[model samples]
Target: KTAVRVSCGEEHTAVLTKGGAVFTFGSGRYGQLGHNSSQDELRPRLVAELWGAKVTEIACGRFHTLVRTDSMKVYSFGRNDQQQLGRGEDSPPSVPLPVPLQQLCATSGLVIENIFAGGDSSFATCVHKKDLCRRLKNDETPPSVENMVDTWISGCDSKLLKKIKKEIHETFSSASCMNRSFLSQSKDKHFQTSPDYPGLDFSLAQSVFKKLLKKEVLSTEVQAAVVQLLPALDGNPVGVEGLRVFLVLNELLHVIQKLKKQPNTRLAEEVAAAVQKLSPENLQIIDSKVTDVYKRDFFHHLFLRIVSDKPEMFMFNDSETLVWFSSEASEENVVNFYLFGVLCGLALYNNSIVHMSFPLVLFKKLLDVEPTLEDMIEFSEAVGGSLKYILDYEDDDLEDQDFTFKIHWDGMDVDLDPQDPQKAVTSQNKKQFIDAYVNYAFNTSVEKVFQEFQRGFFQVCDQRLLKLFHPHELQGMLVGEAVYDWEVLRQ
Candidate 1:
C-alpha cells in the first residue's frame, strides 16, 4: 500500500510506496522534498536522498518533511516551523538531515514506528513491545496497538480522558445554546433551533432516536415514554398541562443530550422507563402529523399492546421482521418503523446475555418481508446517529479494527440447494443478515433521532395527550453522523 502525507504549507504533498520509494509534489520552496532542489515540483518526483534505508512512513509540515525508516531512524529537512521537525529552533536546513528519534524512544524504551506532522505540531509513535510482553506475562490481558498508542500519547489514563471529554461537552453545549438563541429570531421556522441540527423534522428525529436506543445509550423505556407522551401534547394549549409536558419533555431531552455528550447505560435505562409510561395514543397522533410510513410503523409496534389487547407480533420463527414499505404508509411512518427495528437490534446487541434470545426473533420479524435498499438506507442513516452510544463502551483493543455490517439483499442470487457443499454459505448469509441489522441499530446517528423524539413527544403530549402526566423540564440530546467516526477509528 502507498501512504501519503500532505504538508501544512498547503503547497506540498508526499507519497511513500510499499517498496520504500518516496515521491513528492507541489512547492519545493524550502527543499522540503529533500531533493536538494529549490524549484517547485508540480508533480510527484523521486527523492534520491532516501534511497539507502527503507522509508516506512512519511510526514510533512509547513516547509518541512519527516521520514521514518525501517531501522526506526528519523530524517528531517527544510524549515523548522515551530520546531515541528523536532529539530531545535535554528536556521532552516538546506539539505536532508538525519534526526535522532532513537533518544526519545530509548528514554521511554519504546521503538519508534510512525510519524505525523501538522502545521505547527508533530506526532510520532513508539511501539513498546517489551511493555506489552510484560503486561501479557503478568496478566492474561491481551495487548492492543491502540492501548499502546494511548499510553504513549496520554499515559492511557481513562480518568484524564473523561475529564477532557467533560470539558469539551461544556464548551459545545455553551456554543449550542448561544447559536440556538441567535437562530430562534430568524424568519425560517426550521432554523429556530441550531441551523446545524441533524434531524430537521419528526421523521428525522424518530430515525435518530431508534439508533441511540439501539446502542443502549438511550433505553426502550425512554422510547416508550416518548410514545406515551405524544398524544397528550397534541391537544393541550400553553396552559398548566402544556407547561408540564414541556418540562417533562425538556428533562428527558436534557438527559438524552447529556448521555450523548457522554454515554451511560444507567442514564439510558432511566430515560427508557420514563418513556415507557407515556401514552401510546399520543404517539399515534404525532405519527399521523409526521405523515411518514416509518414513524407510523414504529408507533404501531411500540404501542401494539395498548392499541390491541393481543401483542402484534412482527417477527417470525426464522428471525426476520417483515415491513411493507408502500405508498399506503407515509414515508415518515416507514422511516420510523425502520428506525425502530434498528433500535431493537441495537438494544439487544448491547446487553447480549439478556437480549441474545430475542435478536433472532427480532431479526426474523424485520426481514421476513423484503425491504428495499431505499428503506435500508433510511434505516442506516437513522442508526448512524447513535454511533457514539455504541462506541462509548466498546473495548479499546478493538477500536482500531474495521467493523463490518453484512446486509443481505433479497435480489442478490444465492445457491441454497440442500445437497450443495456450500451449506455453510447459508449459515454465513444468516450471520451477515444479523450483523447488518445489529450494526445499523447501534450506529451513532440514532442519537439525532432520539433528540427529535424528545421534541415530538413533548409537543404532542402537551397539545393532545395531557391527562396522563404533568409536564416537567425536558432536555433534548442530539448526536450527529457517527459512522464517519467509526471509519476514522478503523483507519
Candidate 2:
C-alpha cells in the first residue's frame, strides 16, 4: 500500500510499492499501465501477471512501460514501434513480456543493474556484483534437492543457509510460488502448461524429497514446509500451471512411501477436506451468461432434488438416507443415470457438491475393485442381514428360513440362477448363493448404468490419478468422513 516510487507517462501512471508490487492507473491506450489491457483504470490496480518477480524499479514511456527485477531480467510492454522494448517487432503489444537478454548476459557475463524507459529509448546498465548489497539473482530455477542437501549440511551456520530457508518457506506457503516452481526451463517450455502437459518435473520433486529425507534437519524442514502448504491451498487451482503443485505433492507422497516412511494419512485427509470445499463461488458471475450462475446454483437445487426426481433409478433404505442403484432400473431413463455420474464427475473436477454421501461400495465399483458380502451389508442391511443370517444358521435351521434362489428387491423379483429359477439354498451351496446375490446387486443388475455413470464421472477428472487411492481413501476424498464432534473440527 505504500508507494516506493511513481512514474508518469503522457496519460498513464505507474506506482512501485514497497514490497516490489507494481500498480497502474489512468490511460492504458497503448498498454502503458502494463496491466495486460488497454482499458483505463479509475483506481490503481495491481499487475498480477508478474507473480514471482521482485520488481525493483518501474518506468513509463509516452505509451509504453519497462520494469527491472532483482532476477537481473528486464520486462517491457506497450508500444514497441521503434523496438524500444529490446524485443523484435513481433513481440506482444500490450502484455508485459520479458525482454530477451539471455544471450547478452551469457556472452558478456553482464549483470543488469538498472533499467529506464522514456520516449522511444530504453537502457540496461551493466555493473559488477560487488557494487550491490547482495549478489544479484539470476533467472531463478527452483531449489534442487542436491543443492538444498549440500547447503543444509555445509552451511549450517552461514547466511546462505538462512537465505535458502527463507526461500523454502516462501515457496511452500505461497500457491503462486509453488506453481511457478519445478519447471522444465529448457527452451522456456515451462511457459507452456496445459492439460496435456502440465510442465511439472515430478522426477525433480521426487529426487529433491528423497535427498532431503537423508538429513534429519532438512527432512524436518521439508515436512514442516509441506505441512505449511496445506492451509494456503485453494482447491481447483487456476490454470494448468496451478495444477503442478498438486502433482508435485502426489509425487512427494510416493517418494515418502518408497523411503519406507509412513504415508501421512492425516495430511491426505486434511487435503481431502480442503478439496471438498472447492466452490464455484470464486468464478466471475455474469448476469447475461446463464452458465456463469449454473454451476453455483446447480449443486444447491439439482442435488437437493436428485433422489426425489428419480426414485426409480435408485433404491433407498427405510429412512431414504442411504441410496444405491435400483435392481429394478428403468431402461427409459438410463441416460439420467449417466448424467448423474457426470454430476459426480463435476464434484471431483469442478467443485460441485452432492447432498448425501454414497456408500464405499460405489467407490469400489468405480475403481474396478470387487465388492463383497460385507460391502453389501453397508449398502442394504435387510438383504445383507438376511444373507448373513442364512449363512450363520445351522444345517437344520437353514430350511426354516425358507432359503431359495429367488428373491424380491426394489419391488421386483430376481432369480439368482437364470437356469434354475427355483433352485434350493442348502448348507453345501450357501457360499454360492451369497456370492450370486452379491454379484447380482453390484454387477449383473446395474452394470450398464454404472458403466455409463463411470464414463461420465471420469469425464472431468477421468485421468489416471484416480488409481493413487484405495477405495476407502477415495470414499473419504469424495464423500468425506462424518464429523461426530462438531466443536473439535478445524476451521
Candidate 3:
C-alpha cells in the first residue's frame, strides 16, 4: 500500500499505490476526494469510486482532481463549475465521473495518451490510432511476428516463402534479433522489463508459432533457428528486456505440444533442450498457490493478497485456505495469472524463493512428474486421508459406503466418470476415484490458468534442472525451508 505517486491541490491531496489504487485526503469541500461528500478528511482515505480501475496517472487542479486509468480513460472529481471535469454532465456540480467520450471519438480511432490538470481546466492528449499504429509498425526491426504472420497469410508464393525463410533465419538466428522481438509495446511496458515481468507478449508468440506451423517451410526454418540460436542465447543478457527471448521461445514449445495433433518430436526435443539450457542470472515463481508458497514470508504477505483476495478471479479450497484459479476467472484476470507466473520465474531465476502456498503437486507438475495420491494428501488432508482409509479398508464391499463418481470441489459438482454418471466407487475402482480427484484438484479444474502459469514460469527457467529436483526439495527451494527442527543436527 506504499504510495508511488502523489499530487496536491490547494488543500486536497491524492495518493497512488504501487498497485495503482488511489487515496485522497486534506480536503473534500469540492468533492475532490471523490467520496460523494464535501466533508474534510483529516487522513488519507481510499477513493472507492476509482477502485479496480488501476489509475496510472493523477493530476490535481486548484479545486479538482483528474486520473488516467491504465485503459487511458480519464476520471474527474471535485469542483467543475468551470467545466474542468469534462464530464459533459448537468448533474450535481460536484461529482466523481468519467470524462464523457463521444461515440464518434472511439470510431474515429482516437487514442488518449496523456492527461494533465492545472488552474481550473483538465486536458488530455490524443493520437490518431492509425498514425500511432503506423509509427509503431515503423519502429519494428527484423519484422515482428505479427508482420511475418500477416505476410504469410497474405499469400505464400515460392519467391515470398523463400524470402520469408531467410528472414526467419536472420531474425531468430541472431540473439540480439530474437531478444528485441515479441515485446509488448502497450503503454511502453516493455521498457519496464524485469525478471518478474518479461514484457513479452506470450499470446502473440504462441499465435505466431501456430501460424508458422501451417506453412511447413516457415515452421521448419523457425525450428532450425530455434535449435541453433536459442541455446546460444546470452545467459547474462544486456538488459531485462533481453530475457524476453526465452519467453517467446518457451511459448513456441507450448504451442507445438498443445496445438499440434501430429507434433514433430525431434523439433519439440530440440526446442525443449534449448529452453532447458536457459539459466538466467536473476530468478522468481504462481497463482495464489504460486504466490503463497514464496521462500520468504515477506513476499508471501506482500503478493498473496494482490491475487488471492480477488475472490471473483480465484476459487479457494473447501477450507478456503488454499487457492485454485477459478475456471470462470475473467479472460483479463486469466492473463494476470500468466504475468504472475513470469514474476514467479523471476524469483526462481534469481535464486530467490517466494511465498508460493501451492501444494507439493505444483512442483511435481513443474517437473512434468504426474501428481499421485500422496500429493493429494499434502494438498488436502481431509480428502487424501479419506482416500487412504478407503484403500486400506479390509472390507471388500466399499459399495456399502455409498460413494459415487459425483464429487464437489471449489463450488462445482464434477463428474469423475462422465461416461457413466451413475458409476459407483467400489473396492475395485477406489484408486480411480483418488486419481480423478487428484487430477481434478491439480490439473483438469484449473488447466488454463495453470498452463499459463507454467508457461510464464518456464519463460525464464529451464525444466531440465527443475526436473532434477524432487517435489519435496523443489517445494522447499521455492518456499524456503519447511522443516524448522534443529534437533536432528544437534543429535
Better of 1 and 2 by TM-score: 2
Model 3 has a clash total of 29
Off by over 4 Å in 1: 1-9, 88-92, 132-491
The weakest ten consecutive residues by lDDT in model 3 span: 285-294
Instruction: Residues 364-473, candidate 3: write the lDDT tens digits.
Output: 78888898999767666788888899878788889889889888776778898899988898989988888888888778877888888888888877877787889889
Q: Model 1 Cα displacement at 36 (Å)?
A: 1.1
TM-score quality measure for candidate 2: 0.41
Error of 3 at 67 (Å): 39
Q: Sort by TM-score, best first.
A: 2, 3, 1
lDDT of 1 by residue, 130-183 (tens): 865676588865333223323323522445654534432332233232122222
Which tens-of-lDDT digit does each residue in 33-129 have in candidate 2? 7777789999999888877798999988888889888787788888888888888787667788898775586576567777788688888777655
lDDT agreement with native, every candidate: 0.44, 0.70, 0.72
Name model 3 segments beyond 4 Å from true. Answer: 1-302, 312-322, 488-491
- Model 1 clash number: 98
Query: Which of the predicted structures, 2 or 3, would earn the higher lDDT when compared with the native?
Result: 3
